[model samples]
Target: MSARPGGWRRRWILLLAFLTPPCRRIVALGSRELDGAAAPWDRWRIRVHRSICTGCRRYLQQLEILREAAHGSTDRPPPTTRLSTESRDRLKRRLRCEPAKS
Candidate 1:
């Protein structure tokens, strides 16, 4: 078979894709730390990352807010009204009929 143009670029793209996924472990460690299951080293690693990575800092803050909300400590009062079963069913049916969003 003849060599194809851009074949090396395709190989590099596949190599980078595989390599990048290993970094997700750090993000997962950060998540686990927020959830209170982190070891001492994990906490250190996550703290160092949070100190340097603003995105991770924001993510941790969001996790804290969500955890508080899950425990019923929301900053604002929840809606007092409830949707009727018929209304909810209609909404669900409408959603089901809509095309899946990207």
Candidate 2:
């Protein structure tokens, strides 16, 4: 077979690909990193993988967004409800068994 041009580039690409962890491992590491549970080495590997893997980077971003949103939902204050003065007085009257004021 004839040699292809830029074989060195392909070789370099393949070499780099082999050196990095697979996407699944990187994603798992990234999750741990986000949770502050990953080792420094694993975090470094995840950073390197994210630099070259757009899919993993996007996945991490989405995962982080979801994580923050999940946490944020609990931190928010409960919804406030208001009763109008008229309604409040009507409720008070009913509770006391008093006739409604005309």
Candidate 3:
């Protein structure tokens, strides 16, 4: 059988399939700002996207997991959390008494 017409039809079908509402929705949501609360339109867009797109839903779940993990660690205090002041004379005396490295 001749395959030219069949291949052309298949290509059109695949292109239209990729342009569907759900795919567009997911693309919009995936492109939104990830760091903070989205605007009203963005919120709606994300809602629609998540409702239709399983992959984006899973991506949101993974994002939440990573956010939780990022916040879970860090028991140690920062180095600058404490402050100390010593007299310059005391520091100079200590330095003078110390032996020099060879």
Candidate 4:
């Protein structure tokens, strides 16, 4: 049987997708702006990537949701559970004696 009329076109599009940069690269470019280190070229590339790729647009939208959630958390007061003064002091002394793990 002969190939269908649209099969060749679909194959060509699939080939182009393989050749083009993937969605993760586009999201990485967009994320640089969130980290406060965005370059002009990165913004331009992200805009172009978003124009052509719906998946990257959705990924950026999810990033916005996470950013908003983080911002909202900071607006709230700290939890009610409290460390007693003596316990807090002990913890501080232990922390001072040890290297910071992070």
Encode model 3's per-residue lDDT on 1-102: one tens digit a residue: 777867986776566445444655555555454665457766666665565457777887777787777677455457866334556677888999999998
**Runs in model 3 with CA error above 4 Å?**
1-34, 75-102
Global lDDT for candidate 3? 0.64
| Per-residue lDDT of candidate 1, residues 46-69 (tens digit) | 665565556766877887888878
* Residue lDDT tens for model 4, 28-60: 777887787878877776766666678887888
* Candidate with the larger TM-score of 1 and 4: 4
The TM-scores, one per candidate, come to: 0.46, 0.58, 0.42, 0.52
lDDT tens readout by residue for model 2, 1-102: 866898976777677668888998888888888779999888887777777778998999999789888989766756664567899999888878965587
Best candidate (score: lDDT): 2
Each prediction's total of clashing residue pairs, residues at least 3 apart in sequence or on different chains, is: 0, 0, 0, 0
Q: What is the alpha-carbon lDDT of model 2 when measured against the actual structure?
A: 0.82
Please tell me which predicted candidate would have the highest TM-score against the true structure: 2
What candidate 1 gets wrong by more than 4 Å, as runs, is 1-23, 73-102
User: Which candidate order results from sorting by lDDT in descending order?
Assistant: 2, 4, 1, 3
By summed lDDT, the worst window of 10 consecutive residues in model 4 runs over: 12-21
